[model samples]
Target: MEGRSQWGTRAGFVLAAIGSAVGLGNIWRFPAVAYENGGGAFFIPYLFALLTAGIPILIMEFTMGHKYRGSAPLTYRRMTKKAEGIGWWAVAVAFVIATYYSVIIAWAISYSYFSINLSWGEDTEGFLFGDYLHLADVPGQMGSLVPGVFFPLIIVWIIVLGVLIRGVKRGIEIANRIMIPTLVIVFLIVVIRAVTLPGALTGLDAFFKPDFTQILSPHVWVAAYGQIFFSLSIAFAIMITYSSYLPKKSDITNNAFITGFSNSGFELLAGIGVFAILGFMATSQGVGIDEVVAGGVGLAFVVFPAIINEFPAFNEFFGLLFFLSLVLAGLTSLISIVETFVAGVAEKFNISRTKSVLFGGGLAAILSIIFATQGGLYFLDAADYFINQFGVAALGLVEVILIAWILRKLGLFKNHANEISDIKLGSWWTISLAVITPIVLGWMMIDLLRLNIMRGFDTETGNYEGYSNMFIMWGGWAVAIGALVIGIVFSLIKWRSNTSAKEETEDISNVNN
Candidate 1:
């Protein structure tokens, strides 16, 4: 195998980790999830989930990657050959995610350009659906592709591919260092401007107002865990793959804490910015905050473009700043997602870096073009909903079960982290992984399954209006579960060679015996 690259500096690794965690989800999803769950009271469960589940799993993955000195698949293979399938499962999850995730970045790029002239104008919703997408009635329909979406999406793939081809130190690390700081500065400017606008106070109050009784609902707790779980980018192969590039002497625990906290802090700031704008929207229309504020694609594509139209001054420039922030956040995270698979392919097949990046990333880019089509939004919605719920959450549950109970490697892993890390892993870490995380994650999985099963995912409006049951099931649920099946197949394939990784496995064996 060729020599592996390490991050140029410790700060580079931390910033890269932060970049991975702080993606489009933190900015668009977290604020709405918090407000809808329990408002002010949601913080209690969210903080609890962060400490118990988020940071603990982060430290575990970092330990595995740093100790085994390999990507996700190689790390799991070295830890115990039987667990190799687990690592490939993670790689598969990342691959599936990258396919749909890339199109989102394309949308941001298009929106950034649209910001220049306020092209979305008064009918932002109509423009997004009718003019921008020309969306189809359902999945599997071959509607004409929109060049507006396709052209910008192609640019996104080109930029990300160029970066991945540059190798880790020169490309991924440097990209994060530049983009993450700029994201912070530009987003802060957006937030400051938003909060001072007329009627901004109304949005903030609605966002932060406590619905104490809502805290009693089981769903609120599940929302907290889900937010932290998905926000940190855990169990998606990115963290482990990124940490594999760290030097042997780096601090593990402190880095996890930093990454986790930075992600949460950014989510809070995003909440502030989003609500302030929502407040202004409501004030301008003489309506309640609830009537104006939203999240997810509506919040980004439709609502925000509308908000910019309402701006008192420099509407185009403020719109440009907002969309640019989205592009930066999405790109930083997208690079890490693509790199996870690049690392896996290179490590598994013993291929060169450039070859791995081309093959793995090329495949994802080809599939991503599907989402740039007129009918693409339907597919993206179905897949995104199921992938995050079943694919990501299930992986988290199984990971803890394997490490803490099946193999009982948590003790040794904890010791490995404490030995190398500045902060010691105490009994609390053990209990979190063994007990708290698994139970919480397990409950989340079961509850989500139950809800989907009972009503079939929002039958009120059919979740997606025109999509058929077969299309939703196969396109969404099947693709998600198929990832696990494909991963197992990859694990069964012959490894080309892994000399240093195997030596580390022997060292772990010596310590165990």
Candidate 2:
């Protein structure tokens, strides 16, 4: 057996962690979620949730990776052989995410070019759906691949696969060191420009003028927890894999805190920039801010372009900066997502990293093409919703329950983290994972199930976003459930005889069993 890969420096690891945390959701998703939930008041629960669920879980996962020194599946297996499937479950979710997430980044790449001339033209919504996406009239319609999306999709896979093949320190670390800083500088410039616009104060006011009453609602608190959970890239395989590359003596607790806060700080910046721009658009169109506000794809591609078109000057430059920010952010996160499975498969099969990248990443890249077709958005939307709901949220719930309650390993993790961390873990950390997080996440699953099951009665199509039930079944439910099935099945396959990871696990004490 040879030495495992490690980060060149703590800063490199921290930067990589931040890059994974601060993704497209920080830009497109967080602002709208905050606005919809409680305006400025949302931060109360948001910060609380961050402390209770987000950072605590981060510390736990960081400890798992650094202590076990393996990919998610390997880490869990090292924790307890029976628990290995949960790690693969996380990896499978990441694999599903990497497939469509790459396509969204491809859209950002094309939009970055389209920004040069405002090619989306006057009708931004129509341009996104009709011209650019060439969306089908009905759901689940797999029309021909859009040339605009396909070429960029190819480029996205190349860059991501190329990065993964380079290994951790030289590849993933170097990419994050460059991309994360550039993303911040570019986004900061956008934020600065956005706040300086005519109606910028209005947007800022809207964002910060907290309706304290919303804090009283459990739903708002739940939204806060969900945002913190999804935004920080916890409970997925990302944090664990990234931390697995940490050198011995790394500060696990402090690193988790840094990653958690840095991610939230950037989300704050994004919310300001986004709402300011939305305010500008609303003022220009003589409509209320609510009319112009949106999130996700619509906000990134449609509304932003429409707003850019309304800019008094420097439309193309700002558009380029905005979309370019998306590309950088998306790439950093995508790189981490892809690397999760790459590491898992490489270790599981005892293959070279290059071979793993080609085999695993190539497959994800190939499947990503589904989102490049005319029905891509429909499928993308459904898959994203179901995967996030069933895959991520449910997986997070299972992970906490398994680690905290079922296995009762929180104390062991706490001692391990405290030994290596500058900031020692306390009961709060244990209580959060053991009591607070599971309850919140468990409640989240129940609420989601209730809403989804009940939604069928409210719509003619009998499912999410009025997509046909069949489409939801195959495109939505199947993709989400399939990840878990993949996890269990993959765990059943024994590691190859020559696998070094199997030998490495012998050093750790079998406290889990």
Candidate 3:
């Protein structure tokens, strides 16, 4: 095999990790969840989850990646030898995620292009194609495909492919360098614009002013934990894949903290930026704060565009910056998704990097195209919930189980003790992974099931609304559970095979010697 390219520097790796962590989840989803759960009170649970759940899981992923020195599939196979089946599970989960994630990136690019053109204000109608095809109503048009959506989605995939074709150092690094900085600068500008908006303080107050009473609610706690997990890209194979390229001596614990904190801090800042601007808009337009804080596609497409239009002079410019930032954030994370598969292919087949990338990139593009035609936006949302939410949570459960129990049997942690920080994980990590975290995640799944049953039949439309909360919740978990089962079964089979092979190989070598 050719020499695998590692991250050129530690900072590069961190930037890439941060890029993955701080995407739509942070800027788009976090604020919405925070507002819906309990505004200022949501921060408490979010912070706690970050420290307890997010950081530990992140450290575990990073450590696994670095230790195995391979992609998710190969890494798990290598580490657990007998547990190669689990590696496949990670691969399957990652693949499902990458397929749909690209579509979202495509949407972000489409939005950014129009935002720069100021199309939202000049001809909002043109942004909508067929009667049901409105660029602004992504969640609403779940089951419908607009040519406008398909065309741009293809463009996004092609762009991602082009970057991957260039390889990690030249492609991934360059993209991160440009996208990460641009995202930060644009985010700052948006935040400043939002805070300065007349009467924007109302939104800021809503975000910052704590309603401590809400903290007592289990719903709030769940939201915080979900946000922390989702925001940091923990429980997914992305972090592990990204960390695979790290140098041996890098501090996994400190780096995990950096990634977690950087992500959460950005999320908090994003909440401030979004709510502040929304507050000003609400004050000016006599709209309720709830309207301004409406989530998912509503916040990104309809509400944000509407708010941008209010600033006639700078609408196009700021809109451009905002959407461009979204595109960059999405791209940064998208690369990692692509990399996970590419690395897997390379390791699995012992193929050349070039071949691996082409295979993975081609496959992803084809899958995305199919998705594009089939109500891409709707598929993207459903796939995201499935992969990012339940898929990741399940993976987290497996990882903790493997490390805390399975790896312990092999004494992997004993060797890793010196590499780990002085802050020992102890039984707490095991308890959380084996018991606490899984239970919490299970509860969220149940809650989601309930939410779905309630909303599945939309009385208003007399049809199943593509964007029904139930659909997102239930459909997401169904996909997640399916992926989890595949992963666990595959891991067990592969683990047995790998262990047998290793033992045979060792015995033969010993006999010959």
Candidate 4:
């Protein structure tokens, strides 16, 4: 591989890490998970999970990339030859995520324009699914791609590719320096406006009021850990890849805390912004908070549009602000996701950065086009569920096991982390990764398997909800599991023999140049 690219400065790296961690989930998903789990009491388990599973994993990944001094594939190859496939697996998972993820950003970009006039109107769901997406009735059916979505998706790809082609410091770091600050500033404005609105208090009340009783349940704790796992951008190749670009003098522990906390802080801001609007919606409709509140797609597309239409004035302005936040959040995350694959492919194949971005990123963009079709929404939904549940969760579980148990490198990682980091690692890090994380992850996976894999992910009407079993099993599950197979296949093919990995590991003397 060419001499590895590095972040221009510590601030650049920190901003990029925050950008990677803060995504659409922080806005739409975390608040709902908090609301459903324990309202206010969710913070208890949430904080605990953050301390235990989230930060520990973040530190581990940072040490892996910083010490190993390579992209995910190269880093893992340096760690243990047999475990290199795990790195490629992470790269493949990132590729799959980026492919479908961009489609949602495309939707957000379109909605930003529609928000100019509250164009979605009262039947917000219909505008999104029927009028905009032209969603197919059947899951597997691929009707003509939606023109609105296709064009915007192409735009999304263009921006991502343009930035990625510029290499790490010039492209990603510069983008995050501008975008992350802008995201925080704009989101704060939205939150301030939201809280001041009438009935917004009700939404905040619902969001923050502790349903302390729920905390008694074991699942609540598990949910807390699961939320942290997904939110922190670990187990995917993004963090590992990003860390590989850091100077050898970088502070792993401090960076982990900052990145992890920054993500949670953004989620808090999102909660305030989201509930304030949902409160306004409920008040307008003369309904309770529960009736109007929703998460993910419903929250972003359905509820937000309905809320925008009810805005007393400046609805267009508010709508633009809201959707713009999504665009920023989504784009930053998209950049990181693509970088994971780009870095791995470049290192794995000893290709130039430009060529790697073109091949790896170009292919992902092409795959993303399918989600622009009429049946795209159904397909996106299936893929998102299966990939996240099976792919990411499983990989995380295996990662901890591989390091802590299989290879017995957990102590070595901790020592390396403590050597450079301001906050030293201790037995807690070990206990978290070796004991707490694996157990919680293992339980979460088994539970998901029972609910989703074995029983087919339905509660009320059982069996993949209203979708086809073939599409769910094949399209969704197969895509996720297949990432692992593809990753292993890639690992088996060596790019070129080099003895430089050990030199990179031992010779930090040449770092920060």
Candidate 5:
């Protein structure tokens, strides 16, 4: 068998890590979350979450991967055979995310072209639902595929899988090296243009105006932690897989800080750019900022198009740059998401990388095609909501509990990371994982469960997004829970590789054993 691949340089690994962290959510999600939570005052909880939950978890996962020198599943299997299923659960979440996530990038690709001529026109919302997506009247419709989305989706998979087949250092690293810098440059141009718009100051004021009263709210704190959690892409089987490629002497603690800070910095920039333009839109429409505020698909596909149409000058060029940024950001993230399962499949079955890319990437690509249909958006929305809440959040809670309490391995991981890191581990790191994160995440889960239950009872709206309860049960809840069932089944299968049960346990250092 071939030896594990290592990153060519520390810079390459950092770029890739940052690339995974910064994605579509940074552009659309963070700005709205910040505004809705506490405006400028949200930073208090946001910064706290980053330090306590985000960076601490990143350091732990980085240490685990670097020390074990294997993919997420393999790394957990090395820790203990009983925990291999948890690793596969993370991989399954990544797999589901990759499916709908690629379709979104395809939307950006189409929109980039649409930007060239201001093609979406005045009725941006109508154009998106009626013309572009051809959204079905109800959920689970699965009408014929939209060529606009399907074709570009094919291109997205081809590019992502092509990169994976090239191996880690040559493919993932090199792609991030180009995409991350280019994404920054393009986004900077967009931000500069956005801030110069006529009502830019109004938007900036609305964004930065501190609402200190909201700081005491539990919902505000939860929003901060949720944004940090989803934004940094932890517990998605990504950082673990990416960090597994690090060389022996790499600084896990510093790398976590760098990745965490870089991602938050971009989110700050995104807040500025998004709000600045939204301010311009409000001014043009002679309305308040609150009237135009939005996030997710509506912000990207609907509000942004309306804003681009109102641009005083260079509408086409500015629109193109904005959507192109989405494309670049989405591609970089999609590459990382796809690679998680790709690496998992390759190592689990002991198949060649090429075979793994074909088998895994091909399946995800095929599954993603459903999102290209009329009911695609409904399916996408439900799956994304349920998966993030149930899959990623639940998996994260389980991961921390298993490693911290069940396996009692935080001390081992802390010692391993400290030996090679410039910044040594402290009680804060241990306390955050064992205590702080679990408590907050538990609150988040319970809150989400309560909300969903209330929604289920609502007569007018049966479930999330007003979809039928049956649809949410199958499309949303099933997909979220199905990942765990699939993970356990995968774990139960015997390895086809030369790895023996004893070898899995013995391969780790004495510290781990």
Candidate 6:
């Protein structure tokens, strides 16, 4: 297989990794999670999870990829030839994730257009709940779902495909160079605007003022862990796949920390921006702070538009900046998703870059169209629940198992440890990866499941009232099962190919001798 291009410089690599980390999860999700879980109190567990789950796992992925110098599928095969199944599992998870993940990019793009045209703020109330409430209604509004969902999705996919088709140096690298800096600058501008608003001090106090009492709850700890995992993009197969292109001597530990800190710092800044504006809006409107800080669509669609509307003079400008930031963040992450499956196709089928990208992007685009017409928002929420939550936990398990057990058995880690870092892993690292991480994740899964079960079903809308919670429960399992099935099938194909190649190589060597 042809090797993918390495990042031109260490700075390029750091920016690309940070770009993947700092997406909707950082800006859109993190603040909501932090506020709901107890404001400053959420930082406690978030910091712990960052150190244990985020940092260590990040180091593990980078080290594995750098040491092997191959994509996710091939990296695992090179490390544990006998247990090549693990490698395919990782790729499968990545593929599934990429499929639905593109839909999110589409949402961001659609929202960007809306924001740019000032359509979002104009219909703030109605847009949140009317026919335009979800992308699923797009088809109904147009009297044709295909054009409404499929057509737009295909267009977005083409743009992404065009980027990937350019190859890594020209495409991914170039994108990071432009998007990362722009994203940071836009975020800073938003933060500045938010903090300078009337009653902004109150918002800052709400976010920064630590309430130790909230830390005592198990829910807060779980939120922290989830945030750390989500923010870092760990256990998503993204880091592992991206890291495969790193040069042999790259400093894995330092790079991981750089990416981690850059991502987290951005999230903290975003929280300050969001909460401060939320505070000002609450104070001016005489509404409760909680009402202003509602999560999910409410934050982006409802609350944000409301706030933007309040500043009539700068409404359009701020709206454009906000959506542009979303576009940059979403596109950068979308590139990673496209690369994951494209790399898989390249390794699995030995296809050329153009063909691999076309296949991957085409498939994701088709899937996304279906999602878009079916009310893209619902699909987004569901896919996110399954892929982000369940997919991540599953990925974490496979990673820890592969590194702690399979790689150890092959003596890969022993030889590669010196190449990446001087730090030696003892039983503690193994225990955390194999036992502790999985158990904690499993418990969280159970909690999520219990929450769904207790909520029961609603008959009126033919969906659960707590739809997000339901998605997390059912969606997580669906992703895990889909991933497992794909893993087994791909493993068999790879094993057969590897066996045939070994025999052929032996024949050539023997004939030569």
**What are the TM-scores, per candidate, against the unseen true structure?**
0.96, 0.97, 0.85, 0.96, 0.98, 0.87
Q: Work out how many backbone clashes candidate 5 has.
A: 0
lDDT of 4 at 36: 93
lDDT of 3 by residue, 1-513 (tens): 567678888888889899888887787788888887778878778887887788877877787788767777766655545555566677777778777777766666777777775565534434433332443344424454556667777787777778877877787877888888889999999898888888789998877777788899998998888787677876656887888888877878778888889888888888999899889888988877876676666677667888888873687788888888888888888777777778776766667777877897788777776456535555565677657655666666666666655554223442463355555556655555556666777777778667756765645522235455555454455667777677666555422123223323122112212
What lDDT score belongs to each candidate, Candidate 1 first?
0.88, 0.91, 0.71, 0.88, 0.92, 0.70
Error of 6 at 268 (Å): 0.5
lDDT of 6 by residue, 119-147 (tens): 75456767755544344443222122533
Runs of candidate 6 with Cα error greater than 4 angstroms are 121-123, 128-143, 146-155, 405-418, 422-436, 457-480, 494-513
Which prediction has more favorable TM-score, 2 or 3? Answer: 2
Model 5 lDDT tens row, 147-243: 9999999999989999999999999999999999999999999999999999999999999999999999999999999999999989978999999
Model 1 lDDT-worst window of ten:
504-513
The runs of at least 3 residues in candidate 2 whose Cα sits more than 4 Å from the true structure, single-residue gaps closed, are: 497-513
Q: Candidate 1, which segments miss by more than 4 Å at Cα?
A: 457-466, 499-501, 504-513
Error of 1 at 374 (Å): 1.1
- Among residues 3 or more apart in sequence or in different chains, the pairs in candidate 1 whose N, CA or C atoms overlap within 3 Å are none
lDDT of 2 at 462: 71
- Worst 10 contiguous positions by lDDT, candidate 2: 500-509
Error of 1 at 152 (Å): 1.2
Candidate 5, pairs of clashing residues: none
* Poorest lDDT segment (10 consecutive residues) of candidate 5: 504-513
Q: Is candidate 4 or candidate 5 better by TM-score?
A: 5
lDDT of 4 by residue, 217-313 (tens): 9899999998899988999888999999999888999999999999999988999899988888888789999898789988999888888887888
| Window of ten residues with lowest summed lDDT in model 4 | 504-513
